[model samples]
Target: MAGAAIKKKIGLFFGSFNPVHVGHMIIANYMATQTDLDQVWLVVSPQNPLKPKNSLARDYDRLHLVRLAIGENPNLRASDIEFSLPKPSYTIDTLTYLKEKYPDHQFVLIMGGDNLASLHRWKNYELLLRDHEIFVYRRPGYDIPQHFEEHPQVHFFEAPLMHISASYIRQAIQEGHSVQYLVTEPVFQYLESSALYKS
Candidate 1:
């Protein structure tokens, strides 16, 4: 009875949404409604260490795109916590800061199965496994690696697969091809109006 009263559960999804798209929303919505998490926050990273800087869109622009994409979803939110942090954003450090800032919230990391395959390369990934739970969504051609099961905190969700990528979106925009349905209409408008990722 002592533990039955706690209701705050948070899902933390970290990514550089160079441009927020429908695929990202599908996974986030799936995790929020289908899982134990009460809310899902899209933590828009200012930078990602594993990806090349040249390919990344402006941090604030990406954040605004995320906000536009998630509009009016009470359970979904856009966060710019990484914008104030150091470059080459590290998830472990962000997680640590988040935990301290919101002590009552139980946070779970939401990621794609693709990340599970390369999680070991992340900085302090071992600590990530130790300190937080993971909710993994599937990706094409990327199976959840065996070692993830070695950690008791990891959980897999057979999330709906949406074959979309920011890279693809960027390429489409640069080619003057329509990416109309790949992302939300608002997002598409923002990208077109702002002339983002068109290079």
Candidate 2:
């Protein structure tokens, strides 16, 4: 007789994570603890189709920062899956690959309300909604659309509002402002020592 199967529910949070900050950490923590997800994986994109490549930091550096911010969290993980995929990574492709690779686990897409507002603009977004479940976190200004709000596959979760953004942190670093509380200690130290985001 075969052994009983072990399956897990994982939330995939896809981002460039130019420099992982406290806001990102808080959201991931909330998702892992407050929701049904067994684990949350931060999928670091090598190149986001919606973002310009020049505006991003090195892929490995961004991945490292994500690792630092998620330190010692048993339920949180950092994945560089998109790094090995083709450039200008698309969410649909990543999701498909993840589903194929981990057939035993159920994969859910995690995104901000802001992203949800523009989700229709993404490549093969219809297929995404048709095949997978998505967890949308409310952003400060953006609200999920009426139709999507009622979608069976979409679940909205309320997280503590955070105005912090990676671009803001980078700008502060460039202007020589203290980022003491903005990022995790390890990430802060790495940014400072590596002189990252200082133009």
Candidate 3:
């Protein structure tokens, strides 16, 4: 059998992105420019197996918000591949599908230190680390394990500390608070006009 074709390194940033915001974009942009990654794809998950289903907005709405957030950044992209897949999206399943569909593209996982600390609970977590590199950005206070330092595929990046989270944004919006400047103007408008995040 022939080996898969090689293409530019693409960073896979998986998230609920219930409503895409500036913090999300900043991490992506920083990764693209600071790391070896050539492009960053915001993989908007329909549902996360570990998170509450009720936490998410409609899959399409989230995807649309991601699209709006990226705007014309040629290196940034939004993908809704998880929506068409089975429910309770798992990182392993999504990564497997992406590898098959975009064989030419080399993929690296982008996550925060908090996620890394809990990655052992993920389905097929071992295979994920073995098959692809991980770019971990720092979170508020989560400590990365010492073993990760021994792994060749694990990389740590010190991105600006925004302390921003999707849940906080959602809470603020639901309470009729302004989300201005935290997200791009278009995404903020979409969230309000579409009445997303309302309890």
Candidate 4:
């Protein structure tokens, strides 16, 4: 089975992209281009259906923002896999579903340093560490244990990350400030034309 079929290397980037921004695009593009990955999927974290409605359809809204942020980049893609999965999604569970769904694709987990630090606390984390390759991006001020770094499945990249946070962008939008450069042109245009986070 070694050379029976060439598997597609897909990087799974999970996030709650309340509003996808330029930073996410940059990192995703970098990972796709700089690494051996054929495509980098920005997987949107689904909103809990059981929770009370906040009047904002965050599940679909975030997916659209991610799509807008990615634009026509061939190497980058926006995925709403979690939106259809069980609520309170887990990395291992998502990985399992994706693996079963796409048998020819090898899914790699892409995460920030902050997530890496707390990965052990996640549900079925041992399975995640054992079954999938973990790609950690550069993040300031977040630290990880040396033992995990020594793990063969865990790899780190020096991709530069913007200090800007989604909360900051939301706050800026609420204040009626221009976030033209903070996000992609399409996202910025959409936000400008629509009342997204100004509540």
Query: Each model's TM-score, in the order given?
Result: 0.93, 0.95, 0.93, 0.93
**What is candidate 1's lDDT per residue for 1-199, written digit by digit as tens?**
3665584899999888878889899989999999999999999987789888888888888888999999899999999988887888899999888888888888899998889899999999999998889998877798777777666899988889787889988998999999898999999887778778877
For model 1, what is the alpha-carbon lDDT of residue 199?
A: 71
Model 3 Cα lDDT, one tens digit per residue, 153-199: 99999987576778889999989999898899989887778767887
lDDT of 2 by residue, 1-199 (tens): 9996877999999988888888898899999999999999999888888888898998899999999898899999999999888777988898888888999998999999999999999999999999889999988778678999899999999887578888999899999998988999999988888878999
Rank the models by lDDT, top first.
Answer: 2, 3, 1, 4
Q: By the lDDT metric, which is better: model 1 or model 4?
A: 1
Worst 10 residues of 4 by lDDT: 48-57
lDDT by residue (161-189, candidate 4, tens digit) is: 88777778998989989888999999999
Q: Model 2: clashing residue pairs?
A: none
**lDDT (C-alpha) at residue 27 in model 1:** 89
Query: Residue 38's C-alpha lDDT in candidate 3?
Result: 93
Candidate 2 achieves a global lDDT of 0.90
Whose lDDT is higher: candidate 1's or candidate 3's? 3
Query: What are the Cα lDDT values of the candidates?
Result: 0.88, 0.90, 0.89, 0.85
Q: Which stretches of candidate 2 lie over 4 Å from their true place?
A: 1-6
The 10-residue segment of model 2 with minimum total lDDT is 136-145
